[model samples]
Target chain A: MRSSVALWAASLLVYLFLYVPLAIVVAYSFNDSRLNAEWVGFTWHWYQVLLHDEDMLQAAANSLLIAFIASTCATVLGTMAGLAMHRYKPKLLPFMVITPVAMPEILLGVSLLLFFIQVLNLTLGMLSVILAHITFCIGFVAIVVKARLAGMDESIFEAARDLGATPWKTFKHVTFPLILPAVVAGFLMSFTLSLDDFVITFFTAGVGVSTLPLQIYSMIKIAVTPEVNAVSTVLMLITLTMIVLAARFAPETLKARS
Target chain B: MATPAFADLLKFRLHKNLTRWLVSGPPFLFLLLFFLAPSLIMVLASFRYPGEFGGLAPLRDANPAVLQGLTLETYRFFFSDVIYAEIFFKSFGMALATTLACLVMAYPLALLIARSPRKHRDLMVLLVILPFASNFLVRVYAWMIILGPQSAFAHAIGSALELFGITPVPLLFSPVAVLIGMIYVHLPFMILPLYTNLEKHDPVLLDAAQDLGANAWRRFWDVTFPLSLPGIFAGSALVFIPVLGMFAIPDILGGTRDMLIGNLIKEQFLGVRDWPFGATLSIMLTLMVLAWAGFSMWLARKWSHSHA
Candidate 1:
């Protein structure tokens, strides 16, 4: 009894350690004073400023646009890579895709930056940011989708093929339905990753292209603010909602396994 | 309904081969071009110099496609630069420290989660994964407020410590601040895999060990620790790899004084417009990550094979 109690206390304390900072930030978001220590009164003025701040507003818009486009592209590419790896006769595809997963983001970011700025001579902007995001996001999508594919029973595909179904028909009628959940999950994950990314976006995005993260980073450099907290609380809420929804709809088996 | 579908697949093997290629070819080509090709081009460009406005200029006197011929100047310069060398070492040291700290913090948490009552397991799991659900930047910035001197938590702690005759160590803008940021951001990555593996462990085995006259420490060492090795390796890999190139946490918490490898590469590529040196550093960093991953995988293989 004592040991179990000790374990419960330790776990709860560690979790609180993990979340208390986040709670502190959310609490101070409503503080009337710019200083983070004392709360004179509760107010929504910081969030109101976040809404009204023109640069922030534009950066948010850009972030949404880039995340949508990049996630969509990465989903398609990643699904394709997953499909290819599943179906390919070649012995080399797995090693190729895993390379991106193992490479440090900074290394990938710098290498891509070098390719764009020097060889391609493409100016950095929103376009470059989306491209950079898709480059790595595709790897994540492939890995997740590949895991899903590996678990799916191959006999279903074979059964469909035996029933006089064309390759495309078998895919549509059997394989696609089974993989659709993974595809959707991969899409959502890629979107979240693109939205949250900082270093890659920072390196690839130049003048006139500021994502929410870059904007937050610049503000952080200037000085820490309750405004950042207010914005973060909003972000955290949205993320929590999406994740809960995904978990609700994710396949029963995967949910259990995860 | 009872047809041997496996037999049909075997009979149509040749056609299946062609069909599979047809379906998977597009993504293969896409990765080949955008991912593999760009990396190769970067490698090639590392040997060339920027011409017009520091962009790659067409070679007028050489083969039409060869923009600029190979040169070793970039590698030479990177090796000779004191700042680059210092940043590289500092990044490695910080990453190692952060990994160790994460292990220290996470091991206890993982043990707690693994031993928790069945009713609370899901909630416990959810808490571990929660930090990863949000934006990376916001997560780091959250730490900024928590550690800042005038921040409520910091101020409260500071005042309480003063009353007890202790100096509240200045937490913000120090290496300790960066370490805190890292531990906060990465603690989940360490715990989840450990929990996954630990949750699957057979409690009877440990009980059996105890029933056979093993002590608590002996049971833990002989059974529990060995079983958790896979989780430890997975978690360590997850934490160590990214921390090597971590940019935001150090930048925000450590200030300009605590530049890591990531910041150095960024400065070279963007701030200074020195592409070749950046590429050299990136290559070196990539090699180091690969080396660590290879070593970890080898260790995992050895552990499993011994058990087998």
Candidate 2:
């Protein structure tokens, strides 16, 4: 009984530790004070400031554009990778798909930076950022789709094949319908990932391009205004909504991620 | 008639091969081009020389006698300066510390979540992941406010330290703040794997131990700890490896002396434009991460064997 009490108390503390900072960030967004030091009277001035901030607005536009293109490409290719891994169980494909996701983000960032400058001589910009996002996002989408595929009944595919359906026909009629939710979830996951990505984007984004994360990073480094809090709060809401929607689409995406 | 049947079989075989390629081809080529090729370039980059201006020295040269700028200069430089090695050691130590801190905090939370009713487990886990899914820099910035000199918590901590006769250290730009940020960012990684592993453990075993007169502590130390080895390692690796490569935390929260391997590598590439040195440092970091993983797996196996 004593041990159990200790466990509950300790666990609650941990949970509080996880949440208190985020809650503080959200709470301060509405604080009227310019400083983040203490709570003041409530106001929407900071968010209004955010609306008028040209740099922040431009960064947001760039982030969404990059995420949209990258996640779409990642979804299509990742679905194919997932389907292939589930069906054929290819030996090398899984390794190649997952390693980029598993390795430290900086490794991928550095390697791609080297490749961009040295090999392709490609200028670092939005295109480079989109390309980098796609490479990492593909693995995340593939994992989700693969997990969804694994949870399914394999005999259904076999029965369709036995009933004289071509592989393409079976995939069109049955497989696509079953995995659509997961594919959607995968897309959303990748979208959030691409939007939230920083380190990789930091390396690949040349002086001309600025994503929301990059902008936020600069803001945090330079100052601690309530405008940073306002932006963080907005980003948090978008991520929260995306995750909740993704969870509703394919619940297992959350579980399989661990 | 026989010839037509044979032709039909051949057509079917060709169609199946086409289907196989169509299903797997795009992702295969894409990963090969984008992922595999870039990683290979980095490996080659480590062997090249830094260009005079900051990027790689040109690989091709008109004069063949110039050695083409390929040499062991970066690796030699890394060795000649003990500072680089000390940074690596310091980073490793920080990673290790962060992982241990996460494990200690995560264990109780994971255990509680695992023991909860099944319907509540998902919500509990979601709660853990929500803050994590929020912007990473935002999470670090949150700490900047909490640990800033003007904040109440910082004042409290400063006064508390002064009461102990120690100088009131600056809270935001210190190693302590960096560790706090690391722990805050990485605690979920430790919890999730542990929860997944702990949830799988059979409850009957615990009951069996209780019936056999093993107290709760003994049951946990011997049975639970040994059985949860895989989860511990999983959580540890997830925490330790990322923390090892982390630059942003230290960059935002650390002082002058807190330069880890990550900061060093970042400086090499971005600050100094030394691409080869950056690649070399990355390769060394990779090797170290792999070594840590391998050593843990070996230790886990040894631990389980002894218990058995």
Q: Which one is best on lDDT?
A: 2
Best candidate, DockQ: 2
* Candidate 2 chain A lowest-lDDT run of ten: A1-10
C-alpha lDDT (0 to 100) for residue B290 of candidate 1: 82
Model 1 chain A, poorest ten-residue lDDT window?
Answer: A249-258
Clashing pairs in 1: none
Tell me the spans in candidate 1 whose CA falls farther than 4 Å from its real position. A1-3, A251-258, B1-18, B49-68, B81-83, B156-169
DockQ by candidate, in order: 0.56, 0.73
Q: How many residue pairs clash in each candidate?
A: 0, 1
Q: Mind giving the per-residue lDDT tens digits that candidate 2 earns over B1-308?
A: 89999999999899888987998999999999889999988888899988878888878889765445677888998899988889999999999999999999999999888888889888889988888778999999999989988889999998999999999979888999999999999998899999889999998888899899999889899778778888999899889988998999999999888998888888888999989999999989989988987988898888778878
DockQ of 1: 0.56
Model 1 residue A36 distance off true place after TM-score fit, in angstroms? 1.6
RMSD list, candidates in order: 4.2, 1.7
Please identify model 2 stretches exceeding 4 Å from their true place.
A1-3, B1-5, B63-69, B300-308
Residue by residue across B123-154, what tens digits does model 1's lDDT show?
87887777666678877777777788877667
